[model samples]
Target: MEPYKYCDNRSHHEDSPSTKVEPTDCPKPVIIGLYGLPGSGKTARLAELKAELSNDEFAFYDGSAVIAAVTPGGLKALQNLTEEVKNNYRERAIAKIKQECYNTGKTAIVAGHFMFWPEDDENGWSVCTPGDLDTYTHILYLDVPAELIAKYRLNDNKRSRPNVSAPHLAKWQAFEKNELRHLCRHHDILFTLLSPPLASVSKVGFLIRDFRTHSEAYNKNAAERKMLEILAAGSGNVETVIVLDADKTLAQEDSGVLFWEHIRALSGAAEDSGPLKALFSSPLGYSYIAFRQATLLYEEVAENAEFEAYCQAVALKIRMHRDIVNLLHLVRGTRHVRAVVVTCGIRSVWEKVLEKEGLSSTVKVIGGGRLDDGLVVTPSVKAELANYLRIARNLYVFAFGDSPLDLEMLKAADQAVVVTGEEKTRSKSMEKKLAEEIGKNGFHPRQTVLPAFATPRMDTTRLPLVRLTDQNFLASVFARYKNLYVLHATDRPAAKLLMTPMRDASISGSALRKVHARAGFYLATELCTQIIGVEAYPVPHVQGHQADGYRLLHEEATLIVPLMRGGEPMAFGVNDAFPLAMFHHAKVPCDLQHEHLEDTATIILVDSVVNTGKSILQFVQHIRSLNATICIVVVAGVIHSQTISTSRIARALGRFDGLSFVALRLSDNQFTGRGTTDTGNRLFNSVHMA
Candidate 1:
């Protein structure tokens, strides 16, 4: 693995400069330098690399060739000169390469050597001049094993060279790699060591290509293809995809803010002191993509070493949103979930951040650095990636984001989340916009708000905030609220006590009916008082005075309908809660005539259990057909949340504006039984009623 595979990068929220970067007038072409030992085969490698990365924009040249052509006697004359004379020629060679690349608008890759030393020497003096460090945007050293280079050197038929021992070869190789790497950093140049074979040379080629490319145009089909392969090959066998937006969505502060602040502190300048303002405040006005475009430009002029330090500094200070960090970790532990961080922020920054959190291997980050830094992760583009994962990759995608920029992506996901936080900390306009969007789409996303002072170091001993934004919450909200509530679930001791005996095969007769009545009464009263709500009314007190009291609005007109034998005990429980409310037992939907529902403001449908929801749906549908405007509440001991969520019965009931589902327990188990397990059969000690 590369030495920089992991770095301790940290930045603080308190450290920041109150300014913006000024812009530059014109940009320069990026130059990359390929360096290796004399016998390390740099020339052959460069040739192979050029062929592999066949782009018109890329131009390659030999360091000596530039000097030979510019000088009088070419490479032979320079070599014959004294050491001092060679130094001057080397400096001039670099200048010519830089000018040629600048003039032709090409990214140049110049093959060069850092220093020259004899076979007997323990250390080699570096020939890398200040001009070379200043001119090259990036420097990559081909670190072929000394043994491999030694073997190849022995068979070399090209140039005459001195023979060196294995230990001496190792020492010389170490000196060059270590010195060159430090020099590149000292000059703020991007440096990478390519340990050939363990890593492909083509990896560096792709990095260069991506640096110049934009993320907005990433190939969707290709990305899915890669994802599918990863899924099939993954240890956990990923089935669900969780897409998260970075910046304020996953972390406390925007990464862009932290990055600029670090830059200003490192450069010893006020944030607004330069042309950076002009660059960012241009036509796009510091939008995510615009900021990225500026980053690439800023990186071009920035000292490679200093910029990287700032990158690491900001990453070190990063404190991920506590809940989100935990959620991501949870997703990692679950073999079925594949988490993706899709951000419009700097890609390298997030890569470092996730790496620091120890989730880099499992979690993939899809982001960009510069505007044209390859694959713009726009809101629409984010959605495209998510939808593609679901439609083509066969992964169920759940997306979480903040701000209007994430709206499209949220809508494209199979499940979505709008992460919000304290008003003073989060985007107010975005929070409001997200709410409006959810209502407009009619598929409300689970909304999560982090508690005050939330940090990256979340407490795992307690319930995770992410748990509040899942299918269970969504279902419950939808069930209880016409606009929000879905299914209400409780694990109350009272409800559970009743449930134990109801599900027991040993329980039968009045004993089962008594448990059913008790559970129904508790659920009905809780729903009316807390969820469905009861109306306030004036009552006659014992002192012969009127006082404030609560009642179901129009209790005299309210009607309770039980679905025959199984629903009768629960219906009687409803009657006890609303003693004035009329009770009607019916086996078929037609038993409760239109006249029975007339003048009633609320209708309570009571049942012992609702498995598939077909029978209760039939009961409610008949009542709706008679009185379309009456409020309806369904109370049951047990009901499967999943059944009501996906069944057509739920949809048919959804047409009514006033509908509420209240149950003692919303369970996944749907038991079909007779004799002891069956509610009606167990209640009356009757034969199987199937």
Candidate 2:
């Protein structure tokens, strides 16, 4: 392992300019410096890379050849010149390569040396110039075995080389590797140490492609697109989304810490061999380049299968905070709510943890581990995802996170919760920043301490304490954020239009039934269309030309299942609004068979009133059991307010996939009447007999 340079300045959030030391514009032309000891086959590997990569996309060069070409008397006279003059030539060589790459808009791969340590010298002096540090976007070092390097030098006949012992060469290689790595991090250049057998030409080719395409904007856009896909895949009724950070926020244990410990144990490395701690402490900090370097560190330590195994082992060892786990369970069962774990840590590991908890289906994950996972989830990406969910997807977002790395994301959310773990394991570094955010910035976040005894961040006054276990808080969240459409207390003309006849005490029998049925038509056309969304299709215009027309999405595939008796009138109204839809009378859950759901894309369940929500829950659960993904919307004339927060229907909304509710009004009166007051009795004019 290379020794990392500890720097005082560390920026946890790349989006915050005040935290950065001196950030550079990313997506600069990639110039990769292929480096190794004198006899470590860099030239041979460069030639192989040249053949493997496309000439149009990449430009290859020999460092010494470029230096000689730019020099007056080539290598012969340059060797006799002073060290300063030789350094100037080296600078010119890199500058020329950078310029060529800039002009061509192609990546440049060049075989270069960091420093040369002769056997007679006590210590090696670095040959790296300022120009070299500024020009090279990435440095891939060939850490070939010292013995192999010595053997290769002995076998070579093209040029005479100085003889050196394996031990001396090994020391030289280590020194150069450590120094170059430190310099690269300070200069914001990506550095990866590659070993033989695994560091083949194909591996180098993949790295080049990743470097070429991984611009900051590209990464943010890719993350947004991925988040959009997740949202699009969800039930059409999702109104609220909770964005969570995995490491300390979801669990007290940090997966990144556990991952490094696992790597150390597996490799039998020293106790201080926590590469992540050192990497983040370096000048690169938490910038994109820093995370990219961290990815390379993992790649260096383990192969694909071994890396995956390590991640799984670490995931199994992680114990989620009981509070967070309970919160997720509630979120899973709540209607119109979805949770997504957006982690800067390993996505594979968090995914495994969620799967182990059996919350994987309900909670989605957007993260990265290996290079192939698409894009790295940085602080900016996390904030952007939160913003996207709120603005583009029109969702109420609640974000939970722990560190300064999460501040930007918290700011982007509508409601932010700062999770505080145990003193020893928590992010102590976040305290100052959290204070600044609450005091200086206009950001307000509630603090939740795990274990119920762990000291809260600051105090209840500065960072108000919130208990995830609080029933009132959860209920309030459900009531306010739920994808609910109700006409109660509304001043809208349509709400008044539908509720006037339904609320009239003098109206009863066929006259009242007509009003309830009309209310159903109003809810379906006005509210349901907005809930499920509309799709455009071709239609004939008045001029006999084809034009675009809109109707409910999957209108032909929609099935209206009305509970018999009271639900029949409203069901007919719904069917009237969607004339092309199929109507089925379902008195019980079993009435709708698998065939009914097989061709159904949307299921609209109509009822006159939802008293306890027990029947609605049963039907929704049954529909889910038959088809786990069908979109179900419950349309009713009146739903009791308490039923939405505490009833079985409310709970099932959280558990079942793709369910929503639309009601003419929400009644506070939990009145279940019989005889003359019964909805069915009044609708059918049987109240006279009662």
Candidate 3:
């Protein structure tokens, strides 16, 4: 309901060079202004920027209060008094804001409609009189068309208030237009129009904030300094800084089983038939037996070979030192890296490990904790650690982590890493079902493994350029690449295909496509590309006895389709790809016929992106009713690293011989700060024009 609920004022400051006063030796706070009409998604942008800044050292203030104060009769007085007292309230509010900035060392962002005040003329002003414009340090005008604003207003649930009038909306629009143009011409303000969407507005604000605050800190390090130089030289579009946790991430952790085993041995239960096993196997049995005395007796042999083996496993399984070092080198060597470091961990351990491997100087460390207890860690704590590091010096925070505990940190970080642990925590059947659903939804799964220490690599490889004129190229690409097709899978096809293409064009397009095309093309030639619009019918296959060269009849080819925006146009490409294949159209109440096929028929599904393979997985389960041989092929334009690293796709893929993947591109580009073009938009326009 409150789609733009998070949008608000972040801060307020004077823009006059004379009024601009450097507070302290403390890093100058970055002041970014997010300007837009009321329904232009300014708040959502602010929220995202706030989330990113939460992990950095810089402070953020949504200048909503300033707007509220400046409103007619001031926000508080308007609530209690009539319109007559409004002007008096406005003057007081402005004074208070100026005083607050002077007294507290905090920057302010004021959000509200501002109007140009001609020096020579002061005339009839209805809503509120023109005030001094020198208060803001940076002015950003969110140039959104009035038509779009009207659409947003009509659709908005919260703004549908009885008190809001057409007159008020018109006045606000007129004031904003005049003020934005004035700021652009008169002040040294940075004005950016909202071209992409209001969703990306907050990112622009964050960029301004960083430029104002930490640009210098970023220049201190050699690599970062070089990056800054490159950026200054206009060699890059947007430079990204990635920060990651270095424990169970760059290094692997020995299975916690080993640690548990060690604890069991320490408690004197070293025997294979120890009470610990009983405790795990049957908690009730161990509790009822009162076997404490027997367990203690076993403690005498706790430090034996078994216990040592467990410790060795725990230690060795922890990510290899070489791997950690290699990862550090990889991140640092990448020209885009502004800064890289392990934010928090056992400082001594990290230092020792890095030093021994000669990687100590490669990155900075902000770790402090006793090694014995492992680090007392959480996402917020990591966020705080990043905050401290950022505050100590101006810096942007990009982070990577593996557990749910790292979620908060990920939310706070400008960029994030969701590292996958090497374990199948979810049920294998569930994983299989999910993968099938994802395939049916028209997305392919692409996996990325961190290169080995010895691998010679640093800079990312470029993708092969394809000047595709067909708008349906994405759907066509999906149809050709995706490997899995299940009858009645539960996800939309087009959304899946969009993922990889949107993320990393190179990895998914090249590495993934090569492997998938090789395996999937061998499976079948008569691929069935279905454009599920409103319905579909099942084709029956004839049962026959085995014979020499018994060509499989009605071998179900893969079904690949894309989930289109506004309309299901992606289905047409799928239909075009497989002319002879059966077609189905999907709508709210899906209606389709089903006929049982050979148990071994391969089905490859395709989609654009795989944010979460839940839909695709669910769909796979639906098609299982046909009892066809089910192998999945998933083709996605872009694939989030989390899906590949943490999701069930990787584990489930091993379950079937027929399963294969062909992604046009795949990488953790979502939060990796990697640059990627919006292929969906490009492809859509191409197809629309064609």
What does candidate 3's lDDT look like per residue over 178-290, in tens digits?
54534433433333344443225354554455335423123123223322343344232223344566665555542333455565656676546433344324322212121
Model 2 segments more than 4 A misplaced: 1-27, 196-198, 439-442, 480-690
Model 3 compared with the native: what TM-score?
0.25
Instruction: Please tell me which predicted candidate would have the highest TM-score against the true structure.
Output: 2
Q: lDDT of each model, Cα atoms only?
A: 0.66, 0.80, 0.40
Task: Supply the global lDDT for candidate 1.
Answer: 0.66
Question: All candidates' TM-scores?
Answer: 0.40, 0.67, 0.25
Residue lDDT tens for model 2, 1-690: 333332222123432122111225434678899999998999899889888989999999999999899788998888997766677677667777877776788999999888877899776666777777878889999999999999999898987888999999989888888788888988989999887424877987888888878877888898998888787776657777889999988888888889989877877887884888899999887888888887888778777888889989999998888888888888777667888999999988999999899889888899987888778888988999998887777676779999989999998875688998888878878998887777333355678888788988887656767787775456534544333333332456887777888777677878887888788888898889987889999999999999999888999999998897899888888888898899999876657777887778999999998998867765764565456678889899888987776543464355544677788888789999788788888788887777
Please tell me which model should have the higher TM-score, number 1 or number 2. 2
- How far residue 688's Cα lies from its native spot in candidate 2, in Å, is 75
Give Cα distance to truth, residue 191, candidate 3, Å: 47
